[model samples]
Target: MSNSMKVSFCCKDCKRKMFDYYAGILNLYIKCNRCKRVLTLKKIDEKYVAERMINGKLFV
Candidate 1:
């Protein structure tokens, strides 16, 4: 069987669901439809983590 898993998360500013993502999938950047905020995905400690990006600054 495949080892990949599904990942789902919400927007930090709007608290709305962004989209569904697969575990092995890597998206450099994602934009929230509601708030129009940009998010960056980074792999930390072997797991994918999301962080907010504004004006070229990274916010946790």
Candidate 2:
């Protein structure tokens, strides 16, 4: 019964959450707190309720 969707982000190398909130504004230039790895997030739809990982090698 939630109107807002929750999109999660994780570290590709460590598989840990990048932020505390499940959903929030995405910043392309991000550093994973757990792994200390830099990540670039894509602009995905807000309706998606799943985690999307950026590998820096995929073609959108």
Candidate 3:
């Protein structure tokens, strides 16, 4: 079986959850649906994904 896990992303500005389900961690850029802010999927730990928000802040 693959090790990729399904996870959801939340917009830091609006705190709104995105609609799509992403599998595995990606060091890529994504836009927030609500705030239209660009963010990076920074890392994926054992159980959660960490995201970098528009304010240069990290959130889990």
Candidate 4:
């Protein structure tokens, strides 16, 4: 079986890198260490991953 979690947008803004988990596996919110931009992930059947940005652009 598989599982998923609805994470809060603000929760990811932690001071340090924290681990995000789903279905007994570990995943992370790919935020920039310098800019602290919370990288968003598009769920594609667990095998593929990508960043969610507006018009191929990202903000600080």
Q: If scored against the real structure, what TM-score would every candidate get?
A: 0.51, 0.46, 0.45, 0.25
Best by TM-score: 1
| Pairs of residues clashing in candidate 4 | none
Q: Over 4 Å off in model 3, which ranges?
A: 1-7, 19-23, 47-60
Worst 10 residues of 3 by lDDT: 49-58
Tell me the tens digit of each residue's lDDT in model 3 across 1-60.
124534455665787765434445556687776678887666554344334333323332
Clashes of each: 0, 0, 0, 0
lDDT of 4 at 23: 35
List, residue by residue over 1-60, the lDDT tens digit for candidate 4.
235443222223443433333333233456656556666545432222114323322232
Instruction: Give the CA lDDT, 0 to 100, for residue 4 in model 1.
Output: 58
Clashing residue pairs, candidate 2?
Answer: none
Of the candidates numbered 3 and 4, which has the greater lDDT value? 3
Which is superior by lDDT, 2 or 3? 3
Per-residue alpha-carbon lDDT of model 2 for 1-60, expressed as tens digits?
A: 144533345566887766433444444678867668887666544333232323312111
Q: Which wins on TM-score, candidate 1 or candidate 4?
A: 1
Sort all candidates by TM-score, best to worst. 1, 2, 3, 4
Root-mean-square deviation of every model:
8.2, 6.7, 7.0, 10.6
